[model samples]
Target: MTFKYDVIVVGAGHAGCEAACAAANLGSKTLLITMDMNKIAQMSCNPAIGGIAKGQIVREIDALGGNTGIVTDKTAIQFRMLNRSKGPAMWSPRAQSDREKFIHTWREIIENTDNLYLWQDSVKELVIKNNTVTGVLTNMDVQFSAKSVVITSGTFMNGLIHIGKTQLRGGRISEPASYGITEQLSELGITVGRMKTGTPVRIDGRSVHFELMAEQLGENDFHKFSYLDFEPRKLKQQSCWATYTNEEVHRILRQGLPDSPLFNGQIKSIGPRYCPSIETKIVTFPDKTEHQLFLEPEGETTREFYLNGFSSSLPLEIQLNALQKIPAFKDIQIYRPGYAIEYDYFDPTQLLHNLETKKIKNLFFAGQVNGTTGYEEAAGQGIIAGINAHINCHGGNPFILARNEAYIGVLIDDLVTKGVDEPYRMFTSRAEYRILLRQDDADMRLTEKSYNLGLASTQRHSLLIEKKEHINHLIEFAKNYSVKPQYINSGLEQLGTSPLKQGIKLIDLILRPQLSISKIAELIPALHKEIDKIKNRKDEIIEATEIRIKYEGYIDREKMIADKISRLENIRIKGKFDYNSIKQLSTEARQKLDKIDPETIAQAARIPGISPSDINILLVLSGR
Candidate 1:
């Protein structure tokens, strides 16, 4: 049978879920095809969402009307704000989720979304005509036609799983790997490569010695991923246990090195450098005697535990022996041994900033297929791809974020400008304008843009306006309110800050490193009254106000720098140049320019092989 739709999304993982939802929500007839309908938005690796720079990406996704953050909040088993001791920019919100619940929640959303249809099948090939995707042909001999296609085929594109000397043809354990799509794309002149990633073993919680390990509990606070005013986190909270692998464990791992697929010639693909296997860690950090590991709960009710920082592709015997050395895991009973999987990914440089391929019109690639390694990164790309696919089918300007604007911006630009040599993962240091991209203000940065595009709902925009009003009022009050020396001096001295010589504005007191608005509000009745006026999102408002007052100078400086660079971004240069004919440009610069075909002067400047002099030459040639 033949089916028709506006958009067809292959693979129903994190990226696919976001892509399908965004398109469907935007008034498109979207079909989400998956091999298993029950496993939509599956947490194939860790059961947690958001970490380090990843948390910021989740917030950005939420702000842009994506469902990841909302689903994450609803099913969270534990919530923790990472890097709390650091500055506000470094602070990120992470959550351990009920894995099964997460999948169910996403499936429910997919099934209920308007204009969205779900089909349980694997996409085998693309139906292309004259360098444009028409639809997809599934393995079931069903043909579905669409104006645009988004392939979020995560680790299932010709996936090969390895454990010790055994090799399996699967996307995940027991799940069959997909085929034909890669060969067809490769035949169409797209550059494809392989990358490997692994997950750790799942242990039966009853077998673990809880008394021997240090307990790590989640923070109890108003912090969450979504900016909408709601009581987040519905699941029961759980605690994670901290443990470490000692010299004995390393010795056992070393003994299994000969048979390990990662070390042996069985696995040839490049793995994520940041999240390496346990064997790789031992080999890389030989001088270090121990490594910390965490025993995290998979769900609120399930007794299954995920062993973080212990990923391996070693033989089952070796893995078991190594676990026996750790005190908390002396009686460890694992459901299955960890294994590594290698999958095919397209070179992201072959795609435009909007995630549409340069070779195939109306074709988009996202998630691991773009060589990104985290759930947050994939969702970030998915939302963009979905939005652009809708635009491609209908009529609208393509949505693209800048590097200084968001971590999502930085992630995509990094992918297309300088393609990955290893599996890419998001980190705080990767973003140059991180201070401006804080998790605290993702709504301020992205919500209005998505709202203007008719994706973010009216309720979300109203909430943003309300939050802004509260923040502005609070900031203005802090700036105007004066603190008398006698009233605040005692409190200031007790707090280890210097005593005030005279009256000062409350904003000045908040600028001090040791003082916070919450602490100062305790001393003054008027200030507390003003703060109390904000009934909903009180803590969030106060925190936003405090961050603005404290980091005002840094924020302004970064904005100035970003504004200056943004001028170069304004210069249109996509179809204006035949770079190979420009004799003044460096040979490598010409090749890179002709190959990647950058859209702006700033984007051209960001390409690795393009030097400063080459940029000057281009500016001169463009009549700058």
Candidate 2:
């Protein structure tokens, strides 16, 4: 059997979903091939999305005309703004979702989208002709023809799940692992490596002792991930609880180390460093007598609960023994044992910034295939691949985002430039300009670009412009309006802040840590009247304006640094440059530079082996 398409996207995971949406929405006839239709956009790990830097990426995806944010807003059972006490850059939005609803939402959107088709099958190999992907051959021996191909296989390629002494050939818990593709790609000169990641066991909520744990509730006023100003679907708000595992739990886990896959020679791959398993925590941090754990609800209807921090691959009995020791789980019953999965990933350096492979024209790799861990990282790359694939099919230049502009940009640059020694996860610390690439302003920064690519609609562009105008007007209003000392001195004194003896601009009052823009708007008549003009959108407007007022200096300084870096980025290096001829460059830098084939001087500087002196050598040698 054979079918034709403008673009063929393999895998229906988060990355694959976004990739298909992006391509199809851009007027390409796109086909989404997956192992199981029901598993499309499945959250195999935790039934939640967004946190810290990941939240910012979701906002970017929404701004770029993707569906992750909208689906999240429609299905979230609980929502929280993380790091609110910190700077605006660090304030990220996260939500607990209904897993079934998230998957269904994505599928409905894709199904209704024009120029998109879905096929349930596993791709066994690609049909390449003259150094370019023409299509793929599925396990059932069906051929799909395409001008461009995107593979976002996630963890299914030669995946192996470990549970103590037992090993299973599965991508997720019950989902079968994919085969043949890894072997085929290796023959095509794509280097492959292994990465390990795991999830904690799901527990029956009936077994949980909520009284023993500390309740963590969502805010009274809620927020959604989508930028469109509308009411989100209101699900019954749920609360998660935090608990701790004491020395007793640690002792039981340590006893099982002899049979542990992570500790023993059974599993050789490195797991995510930031989200280590319970066994790893016990072994690595011997001094700490306890570890914090969060009990997250899987869905409002189901009794299933996910243990947030107790990931393990110990023997089943040992896991039970350890959990029994924790006070909150004294009478707990495990629905399943935690397991670690190892899967194959290609070295992302072999790909261009648009995620298209350098070796194979019209072929792209995103998500876990690109060695990134989080759903956001995967979706970010997926969108880029989809956009680039569409451009390649119709004849246009590839779209790439600069690092200082968005967290998605930082993610792609880190992948294609630095590559991955381990599973890469995004953090606010990774971005140099987190202040500008904030969750609140993602649409302002990148929606226009996406609109040009035919991803974001005219309404999206208009919405973005209006939001910016409101924020700008609010900021100007605050700066221009002055508050009388007689009207504000009492309020200032009550806040324990120094009382003003003279009249001051409302913006000055906003600068005080003790007073916020909302409070100032309430205290001053003129400011309040001005704010009411955008009353329905006042909260967002005030938040955006306040951030600009609070961190104008730091944000400006970062911009200058970014501008200097952009100059280095503008210095292009030829694709086939001979680094070996530059004798002044270090041997390690020379070898690394030649391997990566960085397109810019700034990208060359980011490689682990490349140094400032080597960068200067490239600059002087290239006569930039």
Candidate 3:
């Protein structure tokens, strides 16, 4: 009655895709089970990927040999480097993808990958024996056996959709709700809660009044997501529009408040804090007269556009009435009304740093099912879970990433340590060593580690080695070369900086905030000649060398601090500790410790109610 696999990955969304790819790529016989094969890797909401800290996670996934960055680059219609004016640590690469093509690209890669298989079915229950998961039971009464299982159910578990006063059982707009698994998991004593997220309505692109909106064009220069040297196919780029909702639009939305699931108490789940619904925005930002809305094309060939900031669960007519008041959408014809979905999510604190369940051996969870809220976040967890599942199946050490190592590390640590009361989204401020975890350096950070783990490919490692050599050579060249005083004064004077009175090393000149390697090339004939040699990789080499020179002090300082705190992380707190029996710990610490079972002393220190005194007591007790 059972078929076999080394790993069984449930759900074929971003998280599931990466997990299956990672496991399969690592030589595990993996089976990817999904509700609909046609919907694999579908962008359930916006048709874009990466932003701010989110972009760093995607690149980290790519560095670790995951398919997201490769798929994104291949299907990208528009690419932009966000926060370029800021420091290199803040610069993130974002791409507007052809949603249809993104999925197709992911599916093709998976199909061609070694040791991976696809099954179309809903997983209803886990085949459990003792305290570990042996496999999953599908809706068709088919049992598939695996040594380890990873569930990346996303928002499809026990999903409920809300449209004003009308409600329906659905995962997405037209997709049916998935059931049985949540109830079954709860029966196994997993702590579960409801989390809500919503999407904006789609409009016929031809119906939009484009003349009234601000045209946000793509940058002329493109930066790709993958560290691989392959060139992605160039697609004709489309422009996105920016518009705002005024007081009039707010008034119209307010009128529909009574019917809103967000306001009418129809949905009690906590929605994403950063990406609030339009209805919530109206009430939360009452004094603000307007809110920005981005109109993004859903696909390269499709005429439908997603109204980015206008997510609402009000009645269909209410959404239409409100849209009609906006200047650009006065005659907007909606393809669908925005709706809120409430789905079951497990508290991520129940998971280990490797994403395996603490309660169930050989079982892991990722993505929205773990209360995270972005595609990049999900993909990051997916690859980690997949790697650990495969390692566990083969009786190897678990793979883990620490906070200072990568953005993916920060995400997993935050979720498992602090847990989420509301849907968690990544922000640059959340990372303490952001200076060390720059998106530009993701390959240098994780590719070797992934390669050692058998997750990253040899070609990825070779490319990384070549890139680092170029960067090092350029850095050494800049440090040794001297710039003539007269060579940079003209450029310096224009930037309002004092002209150089004496010759200085090129690295020193490049370190000045007002001067850049590329800018100085316009003045110094020698520098220009040297830059031309970098050729196709000139911009990338310059960026890497500049950041290393400018941020050397900050990066080293963070590394020292990270090294100190890493000692605390190294001191593990036993999960089986009977916190209740520890009288020296405070009442609140005892309760929190017992509940979270913090994996390390550093993680224990981060809990809300736990204090320095509590950590001191734990250190004394654990003999650290």
Candidate No. with top lDDT: 1
Tens digits of per-residue lDDT, candidate 2, 298-408, equal: 886888899999998888999988999988899998789899999999999999998999999999999999889989899989998999999999988889999998899
Prediction 1 TM-score vs. true = 0.98
Candidate 1 or 3, higher lDDT?
1
Q: By TM-score, rank the candidates, best first.
A: 1, 2, 3
* Residue 284 alpha-carbon offset, candidate 3, angstroms: 1.1
Instruction: Judge candidate 2 against the unseen true structure and give its global Cα lDDT, from 0 to 1.
Output: 0.90
Q: Comparing candidate 2 with candidate 3, which one achieves the higher TM-score?
A: 2
Off by over 4 Å in 2: none
**Collision count for each candidate, in order:** 0, 0, 0
Candidate of highest TM-score: 1
Q: How do the residues 1-624 of candidate 1 rate in per-residue lDDT, one tens digit apiece?
A: 789999999999999999999999999999999999988999999999999999999999999999999999999999999999999999999999999999999999888999999999999999999999999999999999999999999999999988889899999999999999999999999999999999999999999999999999998789988877369567789999999999999999999999999887889999999998999999999998999999999999999999999998999999999999998899989999899999999999999999999999999999999999989999999999999999999998899999998999999999998889899999999998989999999999999999999899998898889889999998898889898998878888888999999998888888999888888888888989999898778898889989998999999999999999999999989999998999999999999999999999999999998999999998988899
TM-score winner between 1 and 3, please give it: 1
